[model samples]
Target: MIKIPFIVSARAGKLLGRENFSNPEGAIIELVKNSYDADAKSCLVVFDIVFKIEKDEDGIDKKILNNDLSNIYIIDNGEGMSKDVIENQWMKIGTGNKETEFISKDKRVKTGAKGIGRFALDRLGFKAEMWTVSNDNNGFNWKMDWKQFDNSDKSISEITADLSDNDINIAEFLKTNFNHIKINNLFNEVSFNTGTVLKISNLKDDWFEKDIAGVFKSLEALIPPKELNMSFEVNFQHLQKPKEFGKVETAFFNDYDYKLTAKYDAEKLSVDFVITRNEMDIDVIKKKFSELYKNTKAPYDLKTLENKVFKYSKSINELLELEVDENNNKLLKDLGSFDLTFYYLKYNVSLKEGYPFKSISQKERRNVLDKFGGVKIYRDSFRVRPYGDTDNDWLKLGARVAQSPAGAGQRIGDWRVRPEQTAGIITISRKNNPDLIDKSDRSALQENDSYEIFKNIIIKVVKEFEVDRSKILNVFFKHFKILNEKLRENEIQRRAEDLVNKIIEERKVVEEKLYGKKYNSVDLFQQKRDEEERKKYEEAFKDTFKAIDDEKIEKDNEEIVQIRGLASLGLIVSSFAHELKEIKNNFDDINDLENIYTDLVSNESKKKIEYNDGINIIKSLKLDTEKIIHWVDYSLTAVKKDKRKRGNLNFIKYFDSLSQEWKNVLKNRNIELVIKKDTKAKYLFRAFEMDMNTIFSNLISNSIDSLDMQIKPAILVKQHF
Candidate 1:
């Protein structure tokens, strides 16, 4: 069978120009990218929607232009194209010019490698006027009506545009409708003589000030911050009055609360993360912390670490070794050096309780959150679209917040910055990371093996940072727990005192009735009655005294229970605070592994490692969580009221179960724990498990403490019949 050849029709332009960009901003950005590819140092966008006011017949103010035009103009000072270049390069659909010449004469990497930037004009409007003068003194002036390309009746080759070859007088061209256009202001620079100018009309979209502002912001983030060789400025004219046109103000990654610089070295196999808090905010945070500490009476001063920037470094293999198998570990050796710089947004006003800046309500706080929010990804200095969008949560931050353990400080819920709560970007360079390339659209990174690897690494590093923050906060807030305990003690004692007073008052009333002299009777009957009343009074006195004693005993018991609870809680909190101090160890290990992975992968050998398996992390996290739970359980048990109940226990079995608990630790310590019966004690013993466990625990702790420094630390549990 013979195959019929097919040719692309002129209608294909409809797809390229109109459908290539997802939005108007995207379309406009494509033009900016074109300018960048041309090695332009500046690109300006002017909305030709000039505003005017005049008097109406009734002498009232009126806005001019009932048509409400929303035209747009893009001008750039770059190496413009000659007539031949325009005809063969710019005019041709799907030309390979940009790909063939990936680097411009100025050495700027070509962002518009697809060579279809002209389609962006189609996305803008139906009609357009273009003027360009090449550096070689040749010029091309053209006009295109994109609607002609949509005619199905015509063949693909039939689509045409008005064109000419001449010295482009940009002023004469733009002055047709925009007579007020400032020629000197736009084309005064000698370098700008040979550049491109696009005057688009028949406005497609009804753009508002907000829309223009959005476009302005996107342009600010378009260029790479690290590409010092490629310096470009973007200006926009939105309001037309006495003329309000200016450069777009961009917020760099450094314009954040926390600036984190993380680097993984290939040869050194080491990871270094430097955390710098915003210098301006140090005093505010430190004051808040100091006040918090004063309230709870925290022991150590954080001032030393507060103002100082922290740098922690470790080997990568140490972090990832226990996480992956030895054979698969080789895969990590191929990774290269990568730098991840992260910025974080702090609340405009600290929402912390007891802070001076508490004027904002919850709803207002959300408004602030919207203003300074979104954690985004930057690959080679350019943003990855949809990653940090209002709808996007690449980190699933919302899910994490929801799943965070209950009873966490409200800060953990509301104040903790989610991806949306953060306003920052991670900068990665394409030169160092060749494997992680941007997609043709340049909107995001290609979801290849490298992309997945990068994403996981980022998440792990961020999670570690998050944990570090929590650990720090836990230390600061420990005092609050102490303050709460004190308040609880005062309350519990007040209740117990009232209960004891009530018992005493109740007994006093019975004694008063027994001794009352209101009763009168005949001599004999009265004497007998008095005798009986004396006996009754005696019994009543005995019972009443006993009741008072019991009430006092109960009051004292309650006080003891309260004290025990507070002490237990203090122990747990103290241990946790200490652990938080050492929390760096856990994450330092991970960092160590990360460095090794980087060194191995980035080494000359180009090794490969499988470090994406998160199971090890899960296992480690689970073990830590279980330990915390056990601490809490012990605290809760200390305060429980019904723990003195008797239970029959098989001492042998109990010892066996307890021995199993220490088996792993014993093995790790190179010691064996042996449990034996000193005698044939077969009979069951009635005792409180609480008391038994307490006694056994003390003995075990003592033995372990003494054996800790020994060559082999062993524990022996025996039942002495």
Candidate 2:
């Protein structure tokens, strides 16, 4: 049979370049990644745009004339390629060189694998020129006209690019052609004998001031934060907008209200998380905090640190149908470790008062969020695409907020945080998580088991941030509301007192004129004054009582809301308990059959079943199942439906039930729990049983925590009549 040869047309360049890149920003970023893979310490991006200065209300503004005089230049001090290397590797499409040698000489993970990154030049402009010098001091000039590839009849091999050896002055070239003031200083600061310079003309897109600013913002976060020991740096310069030029640093808010960090450990199947409130914000809230009602106080608890192991939590284990080892450890061995950091800002009109952080205006804060919000994923210190983009709700936070809007089942003035209110970074690496692969289009991580687990874990951590932030914000809003109400009341009382005094003086003057000296008679005047004073005292008492009553009603409403929230949680627990009972029953049936089979096999083989591997496996499974069933029973007993209802709860019976329920747990911990009766009289109270459970649960849990360090620990519940 005759072998058929595959043919590729020159037009294929369009598919790889223009069609592949969703935007000019992405195309430029791809080229920058190439520079990074070359182990470059610094990369400079210049937007050469022709513009005329125009005066506006905000002073001088650059008006971009047109794209006719726009050119883009990207320069990097990297290990420049030789002629042979350029032709064999850079010139070839879909090269596998990077795939084979995935690490650079400096031990940096190669960011480009597909090797079509060179086509990014075509995506940016119609014509491109390059100048490069290798370590041997040998220079080369390369030029390509992308318009030549538009011809459908031309074969890929026929369309040739110009590449030739030439001696080039790197510094002189920039001064002679660009004629920019910063060029001389930049070349002086960055000393390099070997590097690459790419110039693109006949621009594909107009380079306006706004466009340049957008690109600069993206470049700011293109690499990991400097604190991560990322040696590389990026700089941006717009020739027309010289004032906007600066070194790109990671864009983050230094005055964020809350910062949360979560680190996962794959070996332990656990995540350690820390949530910290900004000290300045906490201080401001504390200062503003007032007794809105009698004896009311703010939730002053600020941050939390928890090392949560993945274990018997059905909500977590059910996520992956996870397998447990003999020691009851989840076998999520494939899910690799990752670190996530998030910063949150509670932006509301109420927060305007006592805003203790940097005095960022509302407009400025919103602009910052609009520019640098959303959670982005970084791999090998480079950001992946589309995940943290302004409109890309990869975490689906917006949808979650929509499902449970403010006041759905939460405290008053508490709302779910919107996607724009947070900025975050999730760091991952190929060496750690090989399964989380990127798609060819560089859109996002491929939809796979590892990726799903990764997103779920991040969402879970973010939930912690949201919950704590809500609590603090709720307090702030309530205090603000109370302050406003107090001010209004004070103003009304002042006006009322003024009006009453005016009317009383006017009546006294009229009475003096009508009745003469009789009106001034001691007995008659004294009786009238005494009556007026008595009436005023009664009115004052009524107003004061009304204010107190209003405060009491408000306090009661808040308590009712908290109780309802607990009831909501109890509802969830009850539902899970039902499902757990079903699961336990099914497992018990399986265990019984396994036991019977083990007995039969032992009899048939004329040996004990304990020596057989199959019997041992069954026995281990049964033990785990029994443990799970016990956990289910404990939960079901703690969250009985009747506990969530309001009624006359007998403290004696309640304490007795709690002692019985906790007897096994306390026994296992080598601790004793006792309920002491102080009197023979019945002790009862009107309350939601769940509220009592919550109060006692907190007390008991705290006692257990402290008991861990005690040699002998006991919990006593005293019942008084």
Candidate 3:
């Protein structure tokens, strides 16, 4: 065999850089991730905006003009490259030292397995200057103009980047703590023992305020979640006019009305996704609830309702957990169980001054929330690009909600909560999961079953969360109603005061009568009139409050009955998945499933199973189909009440109905749910049927969660007379 030297094409950089990075922001993210893999403690992205002001042909006024010259500098205090490494690893295309060194000095798993991050610098601009200092050497510098890529005659091997060992300038710079300020200074004099810097000039495109803002937001997403050991600070600045850009402080994810957390099992299954109630908000809610239920008597048990206030436990500020079903977790086995935390500002983002919020304006804070809001995916402490885009609804939340007719009605209510309303990050570890493969180009995750299942799980969980939230937010609506009632009371009081004044004027006129007996009679009549006015005003105030309460109850009832369709959809999908799993399991036992079908159609010699088996298979298929239909009917029945009716409900009958609904789920999970009343009393209690459903469902859900953690689990739902 004759061996020949391999020749690489010159257009490789164009293919790797231009085609690899979906956008400039995508390229920037790769470089930032490179910094992270190097164990960076802090990364600074300096957007050195250049400007020139000159008077136009008219000499009176100065106008700002784009010099068409702006530089982007990314400096990181990470492990820097040495001279030899620059030639062998840094300059090499589609290859890097990260593969051999799979972990950092901090034991962080390396994410640059494909080694395409070198393309990031190329993606940023046509010209680049790299200055790096490592403990192995004093300094190493490299400069390259990518215009060589335009030459059709040259191969990638023919296109050699010029690199040099700069012991004079860079060594002195490193010796001076990386602080050698140039006369035309463009970057900060960062003091670090070892670091790397990339100055990208002659940018591929113009850098505007929006692009800078987008870059800032993207950089924020690049920083790994605080829960990771790989936490780093990212800060951006304007080199020309820093003050005009304002003080850009590094911020952590904080401002939120609701925080949701999903805890997964060892199998990467989402065991529970908790939509938590803020304890501070809960405390205020408790006070308001106390006022509402102060003396509320028969037909409504305020004590029981108060106990379940906003799904909170009796403890101070503890999170209320939303228990997930086992069927929802089957696909997570190989996906690697990870934590996904989401923060929802909801409509409450408008609230005034609090910690973190007090320092920032409402506009700036809103901008931050809107910009950063999306479910970003992270693998081995590095973010996957394009998944959290404003235009990309990876979770398909809006589509799913809009499709469901149950979601506040398409005619009057706007129930669409877009992906931007929520900001979240999912932490997935590569060490634990070998199946999660970052694509060759390192642009996105592999489009496999694991990814599809992962996406499905999140949307389903979120849909449930939205439904639960809609119910909980009714508390705020009720609070608003109370405020409106207060306003009405004020108006009624004003009218009563005006009437009282008129009566007093008449009394004054009557008392001015000449005769003493006549004056006394007029005074008595005036007093009687005053008492009637007082009585009338009290009755009017009472009636107005009663009307307000009636309105509140009616609205609450409407919300519960017209329940969000997403919740039902999520459950339907969950049940459907379960049925499919069962069908597959059934088929798995039949080794001759394919042969059985063939045998039933023809007079074949020998098939593995008899023709009768085909009939059984068909019957099983029909049964599962009916099971799916049963659940669909059940969901509709649960929410299809024509009108809100208030009356006594028999405890035994209600529990029986609830148990029947959950029997299959309980049985499938090998869980024993025993529903026995404390007494033999056949007592009936006053409550809406919908209220009972909420209470029982939550109880069942919590019990299921506890049972999942046990080998043999049981729950007792005992009601007292």
| Tens-digit lDDT track of model 1 for 1-721 | 9999777777875776565686889989888778877877777777766445789999999765422465788988888887788789888888888767767888765665566778888887888888897788788889999888888777667888888876865545554545444434554443466688988887676666567778876766565553223477776776353255566544444344556667767567666888765423346656665565443321123554455477777666654433545543443444456776666554455445333222324454455445434666664345567666664566655545444422223244223345654655565554556676767665677887767656666666665556555544565456566876676556555555555556555655676699964434457886685567555555555556557766998999798767656544543443354354455345456556656655655444343234344335645765565454444445444433334557787777767756765555555457778877744567478877668767887887777777756576556666775
lDDT of 3 by residue, 1-721 (tens): 9999976678865686677777788888778777777877767676776656777788766535253667787777787888777888777776746767788897888877776677787888888988888876577778988888878678887887778776534333533532323311323444456788888888876666677777777766666756555566665666554644432233246666557777555453324655554423434545555565465552123454334322221110112132455643444566666667777654333353221111234575568666666788877876777677665567766555545444322222334455556777787877766676777666678878777766765665565556555544444456555777787778766765666667666765776764443434457886797678767766665676667768999998678655645445543554355355565455443446555565657666334366657667766765565565445545645643321356888888878878887776676677877888745677687778877787778988987876655576888888865
The candidate that wins on lDDT is 2
Top-TM-score candidate index? 2
Ranking of all candidate structures by their lDDT, best first: 2, 3, 1
**Candidate 1: stretches off by over 4 Å:** 1-6, 49-70, 153-158, 169-191, 208-214, 220-230, 239-246, 253-257, 264-270, 278-307, 314-338, 348-372, 406-417, 429-431, 434-443, 498-721
Q: After superposition, which runs of candidate 2 have C-alpha atoms over 4 Å from their true positions?
A: 51-70, 279-332, 349-364, 406-415, 470-721
TM-score of each: 0.58, 0.60, 0.55
Instruction: Report the Cα RMSD per candidate.
Output: 23.9, 23.4, 21.3
Model 2, 367-433: lDDT tens digits are: 7677667898889889987788875677877656644556411463345667878888888887777
Error of 2 at 586 (Å): 48
What lDDT score belongs to each candidate, Candidate 1 first? Answer: 0.63, 0.73, 0.63
Tally clashing residue pairs in candidate 3. 3
